[model samples]
Target: MSNPHKKEQHTGKDLPRWGMVIDLDRCVGCHTCEIACKMENDVPLGIWRSWVKEIEKGKYPNVVRSFRPTLCNHCENPACVKVCPVGAAWQREDGIVMVDPHLCVGCRYCMSACPYEVRYVHPQKGMIDKCDFCHTRVDAGLKPSCVEACPASARIFGNLNDPKSDVSKLVSTKSVTTLKPEMGTDPRVYYIGLDMATMEIKREAKLVWEK
Candidate 1:
């Protein structure tokens, strides 16, 4: 594994704006992605870098289970980056939001400002942490663990700036929507076939952080 702290080289050509698109229609609610993320990032037991939110709909006899995968949105106008007083939270040239654990003072300012509630204080290090799309692996030219481990192939990761990328094509051609578009964050994560009722739901797992 490459050292995650090393600064990656950047050339002046068109930088890829990395993003994701989840095809809810293809998701199986298997939680494979949830497990894969934890294994890859070594996320703490109580905290999650990513998780699947499941909800049952319809009457007893006729019911359906819907899943919403929760992770850092990596927003274009990230509130975490804007609110970080120490500049610990920053966005990469490719739109991935990252945190500098060394610079973080455990102020929790970013945690409060973030709408996604994905950020958490590392139990041991006392630094803020969250999903960075597995930057080290991505920098190594590998797909995110969740993307590769998804059995249904529901999670699509790619360069949104490139029209040829799958994520870009789906986002432009499919009926996709992002979480909290009204917040004006311009979240890079988009979802297809996301239930309208669950659009505003913050999910029970996300609330555990406050306790």
Candidate 2:
């Protein structure tokens, strides 16, 4: 199969169920993806639509470092979508969870409901803001900003339903995991080279803002 991970001419019909694969082995904790996402989305300094989480393991003598690029998981059963009192949070057919800024009343319910803690209330706009997988760019035949900017090529985005797509192949053929499976969100974002430590949900730090 062709390396569908790269931006190229796609020959097949556009598939449904957009998703992502992040290879932890390829990630270097550079935060380039974070900067790219912020620039592309115009996310303010105090908040992040996407962030790179640094995880360190082992004692000082055997120290190991890893990076996890986190965003809205865009779950198959989105908690945010269900909890939005005004229906501001909703999931598209393709699996992106979107917040309608105009309809949002800054209630922060969706923020609380999200297990990934990717959602944040925009202090200036009084609305919720989070990753939508750069849907506008994806619609324009482009990858998400973070995926495009990762120098290590650790991020892969494509339609999960297409068996021929790189993302689908990776998930099928490799060891993969989703964050907080116990939450039963069935998140579309899959991770390669992640350990149980990385998947452990930290409830004390609730929101991205708290981090």
Candidate 3:
């Protein structure tokens, strides 16, 4: 078998529109995907490009545990791309938002522009970094590290434009949701069985950058 991590060259033609569907029902909040993403991307200890949000619902006797796994939404109209003074942040034709480290001046403008608050400035590298849906792996015809590492198989990744794809089918049939839709970012990431907590932003919630 070929090495899946090795980069595969592609001609600039009709490329697939990449997207992800996360089944909140299947997510067990194990944090396995978090570790895999960190390892694959060499993320720092204090911050994370991807993380799980735990929501406790109902009273003790009838309580329920729900988890929301979050990362960059790779929006269709990314605020980060517009707010970047140096044009460091950009979106690809396939709808993946990427930050060019070479162009980045560590301005943190994108961090503020993102409503989801997923983007963060790397303390060590002095550059903006966030999940790009593991573009390197996707370009290599492999699933993202997080998706591959998911023990419960909660995450499904594929072309949303292809009707035959699992992601497309699920979106068409299931009542999925995107975060902060009012922001008009048109985020590509979708969720099934999303809880109320994940939809509401809490100012008291600890930030990833907060020490």
Tens-place lDDT digits, model 1, residues 30-81:
9999899999999889889998888888998998988899899999888988
- Give candidate 2's whole-model lDDT: 0.85
Q: Quote each prediction's TM-score.
A: 0.89, 0.87, 0.89
| Pairs that collide, model 1 | none
Higher-TM-score candidate of 2 and 3: 3
CA RMSD of each candidate after superposition: 4.7, 7.9, 6.2
**Across residues 76-160, which tens digit of lDDT does each residue of candidate 3 receive?**
7789888888777877777778888878899888898899899887989999999999999999999999999999999999988
The lowest-lDDT stretch of 10 consecutive residues in candidate 2 is: 2-11
Candidate 3 whole-model C-alpha lDDT, 0 to 1: 0.87
lDDT against the true structure, per candidate, is 0.88, 0.85, 0.87
From the highest lDDT down, the ranking of the candidates is 1, 3, 2
Off by over 4 Å in 2: 1-15, 199-211
Error of 1 at 120 (Å): 0.8
- lDDT (10s digit) by residue, model 2, range 126-150: 8998999999998898999999999
Count of clashing pairs, candidate 2: 0
Compare the candidates by TM-score and give the number of the best one: 3
Better of 1 and 3 by lDDT: 1
Candidate 3 segments exceeding 4 Å error: 1-13, 203-211
